[model samples]
Structure formats: C-alpha cells, structure tokens
Target: MSDICVIIAAYNAEATIAQAVTSALAEAEVAEVVVVDDASSDATAEAALAASDGSGRLIVERQAQNGGPSAARNRAVALSQAPRIAILDADDFFLPGRFARLDPDLDLAADNIVFVTPEHAARLDPTNLPAAPREVEMLDAERFALGNLAQGVHRGELGFLKPVMSRAFLTRHGLRYDERMWLGEDFDLYMRMLLLGARFGLTRAVGYAAVQRGASLSGRHRTADLAALEACCRAHLEMPASPATQEAMRRHLRQVQAKLLLRQFLDRKAEAGLGAALGFALAPPARFLPIAKGVARDKIAALRPPAPPRAERFLLPV
Candidate 1:
C-alpha cells in the first residue's frame, strides 16, 4: 500500500493547479492527493478535478470561506488517512520517484528543491535526475533555525524545503499549523516539531521543482503579516530550549524583527513622508539600524544595472 498522502492548498491557482495535481498523482508512493480550494474565484477546483485519473486518488474540497494556506492545509490533512503527509504547493510539484529517495523511518524527510521558470518546468525531464545516491544529513533544532535566516540575495533558506512528515508524529505531539499565520507558517511548524525532538533528515537528491513566480506570496509580504511572524518567533523563544537552540532562536528572531522594522519604515514613508518614517524608526531605539541598513541596500541596488534572469536556479539548504 502507498504510504504517502500529498496535500495542496490552492487559492486562485487555476493556471497551475492541474500540473501540481498530475505530478503528485504520478508518484507511485502517493496513495492520495488532497487539494483544498480556498474559495478561489477562478476555476482552480475545476482544473484540479479535471486532472483526476478517476482512480479515486484525487480528492478536491472547496472551503466555505477564503481561508489562508495554513487553514486550507489543516483541512486537507483532516481528510487524509495516509501514514505520511507530504506538502505540495499549488505552484510546485514532485519529481517522479521522489519518495523513493528519502528514508521513510525518519520523522521528517526532505530533499533538494530546484527552482525553474514555468516554461522551463513544463519541459523538465525526470530522466535528467542524477543516478548517484546522496548522503542524508540529520538536522537538530538549532541547525534548522539557523539555516532559515535570510542572507540577502543568497536566499538558500531552509524554510523553502518541503519535507514529508510522519502523520503519527504530528498527531502524537498535538501539532498543527498556526491558522493566524499566512507567512512563515511552515517554518514555525517544522521548528516546533524539531524542538519536540522530531528526527529531521535531509538528502541532496533533487526531488521537487518549485516554480518561481514574480507574484508569489513569498515575494509579496504585507507588513502586518511579517509582524505576526515576528511575534511567533518571540513566543518560540519563551519555550524551553537548549543553549544552542536558544541562541539560534534569538538570531532568527532578530532577522524577522529586522524585516518587520524595515517594512514598517517603508510603509510609514509611503503613507506620510521621510520625516514621519524617521520619527517612527527613532521611537524604538532598536529599529534604527535595520531600517538604515535596508535603506542603504536599496540605494546601492538602485545604482547597479539589472541582471539577466536565469532559466533554472537551485536553493540548497545552508
């Protein structure tokens, strides 16, 4: 019997939902594919339904209201019964024989992800995957937190890696996605599971292709959403953790806070003027440095020429 149930939370993803569904259904290890349509005004649900092979493996559910990705994912999980749960974004897909690359015994398992333009992704061949076996790295809570930190243009954030999780482990720990968070929710859930001593294994084998879009949610974040993520980090810090984990958490918190501060400054500047932004930045003594550095980076970037886009990119775990 297949052990994995692939779940997708889609919103206004009619353009790519069928591709995502077909890719998941192609994997032999996937017993079922559950897609939750978050009340999209488009034909996302219809597209997903059309991709079904009529094998009863594809389950599509329409939400009563437009909930965020977290809420939609939670709903999909409730409708799935497989031992393992794999998250497949509406704009991303799994490669053929992807589940065979990971160790199923581990509590959580992930593989390398390749980023490609939608056009390139359509022609991507599964036979191009390397035949060599890859070594698996075990991740500790501290290491996981540290790897998610943003390093400017070098965005090899571990938060982007979608891992296959043991449903039993999640149920045993009483853990679910934070419904309030539309951003950083995956990272938060994975971090909490790691803190609970969940064994997370990662392999360098390429098994997933994440479509890079200019309008992706990861690229367009609201200030309020970022602030909520920062608050979540603070709450995580309050929990009991090892010295190393605590330090890593602090660093992660600082990064989130920095981003939030920068966003707030930008919003204030846009709403009022430079003077209002400066006043807001100065009101909290800690916000000045991040905002200043952010402004400097923007100014420097504006002076440089734009670079050409790439056909394919890889974001390896740091």
Candidate 2:
C-alpha cells in the first residue's frame, strides 16, 4: 500500500481506453492501474488488454453485466490495496507527472488536474514542455468548495475535478460513491466529504487530458437530474454553517427550485417538480441589516478612489 492505485471506470470506450491505461501506467507514482469495464458490449476490455505494457500491475476487471460508473469504480477500489486512489474516466488520460505532482498531506494537498479535450492534448510537444504537473498555488477550502460547486450544487470543478482520495480516510468513514445515483454522484461524494470536514487543497498540478466530452446519460433524464440536484441542495442547507453560508445555500435552493418548476411545466415531470415549485413559492423573503447609519455615509465609501492595482492578478486562468 505504499503506492497509488489508478482506477479507471471505462464503458464502451474501446477507442480511448488504451491511451488511458497507458497514461496511468506512465505515472511513476502509480504502483498499479485498475481498469473496470462496465460490461461494455464492445472491445473496451480487449483494448485494455492490448494496451497493457505487461508490467503485471494493470488489473482489468470486466463485469458480467452493465452496472454503472459508480458500481464499476466501487469494484475497482475494492480490489485495490493502495493508500491513494486516483480516478480516470476511460476517455481521459493522465498527463505526464500526474502522480508526481500529487503529494500526501493527510486530508489536504489533492491534485489540481485540468480537463483537456482530445484536440487540446495533441498540440503539446513532449520534447519542450514546462515539465509535467507544474505546481502553481494552494486553494482555500470553503472558497474552493463554493467555486467548485458553482456550476450547481450537484456539480463541481477544480478542488474535486480529479479526486485522489486517501483509501484509509474513505474506509474509516465508510464512504463510497452513491451507486444509486445515476448522476450527480460526484457532487454527493464531495458534499459529504465537505460536511464531514474534509479539507481539500490543490497540488496546482497533476493535470490530465480528457479525450472527449459530451452529455452524460443522466443529463438526458432532466427530471431525475433536477431531483438529484435538489436533494444535494437540501443536504447542504441541513448542514451546520454560519449565517452567511446558510443564506447562500438558501438562495441557491431557491434558484434550483425555480428551474425545477419550469422544467416540470415543459417535461410534465412527476410530483417532485410540483413539490419544488410549491416550496419556493411559499418560502419567506430574506432581510439584511444595513451597513451604514446614513445613505450619505454608505455613498462615501463608494465615492472613494479605487485601491492601487497590483502587478500580479488574483486569479489564474484554468
């Protein structure tokens, strides 16, 4: 258990599974690569077999029946014996030094891998690169979580974009991806980790190359997706937090519910949609205290000259 185990959940990814396996094997920090095939009715398994460099560490588990990404990943993790698990979708590959960039620092120091399309990954010249996984910055926990989930409560970005969870940490908490959820399962896992006080920081490295992107199977199930998303939001609202954080969660819930109502009208979804609409419609409005005693006093701050700009920008382009 001294090395990292790379887990890849591949489904009907015959065309890209090879590169993914190869990439994982390329990582010096990776001791083994587990590729779980979700009963693909194609050559996904065969491609994985063909792609192996015969290091005897690439374990390919081909399921008998089609289960889902969650089930596939769970199976892979169950068979692995590494302390850290780095996940890669079949259509994604680890950029060089991905494993090298990721460091172990208890619950923090996770990787900061970027998602690059197939076309995007092809233009780089291996001979003259800035070196794989160049570390750049650290991330704030709450801010990272909020920004990661900015897309939606059930969606996340950077902090969790490429999770490399500590095996001991997960096992101790009895935590695993929600197999029941067809979509937003990652969101659920991240939220649960955050609630339980998992502090995630960035390696500012371990960038990976995602060969392709498209709508997920759950994306087509708008009703189910929204329901899952709402469940995620409610879970957040129930968690202990400061007044400001709770208010932000409330505002997010309102926005989600409003959309659920409209989707219900167009898709004629189940009772869930109607319930969300009613919940938002009947919710009380929020009030905030004024910052200043006088309007003129408030305007004084706004009228002041802007602070001097720094040469270094606060945000880095992803």
Cα RMSD to the true fold for all candidates: 1.6, 9.4
Runs with alpha carbons beyond 4 Å of true place in candidate 2: 126-141, 149-156, 215-221, 251-259, 269-318
Give the poorly placed runs of model 1, Cα more than 4 Å off: 129-133
lDDT, candidate 1, at 129:
50
Alpha-carbon error at 165 in model 2, in Å? Answer: 0.9
1-318: candidate 2 lDDT, tens digit per residue = 248898988889998888889988887788889999999989999999899888888998899988777888899999999888888878877767655555675453455444444565666433343334355344433454456444522223543366677787788788887776665566567656666667665644436554435544634557666676677778777777667666655666665555554554445324557555445433432211111122334368689996543221111243
lDDT of 1 by residue, 158-246 (tens): 98889999999999999999998999989999998998889999988889999888888877789978988998899888878899999
What lDDT does candidate 2 reach at residue 186? Answer: 64
Best by lDDT: 1
Q: How accurate is candidate 2 locally (lDDT)?
A: 0.65
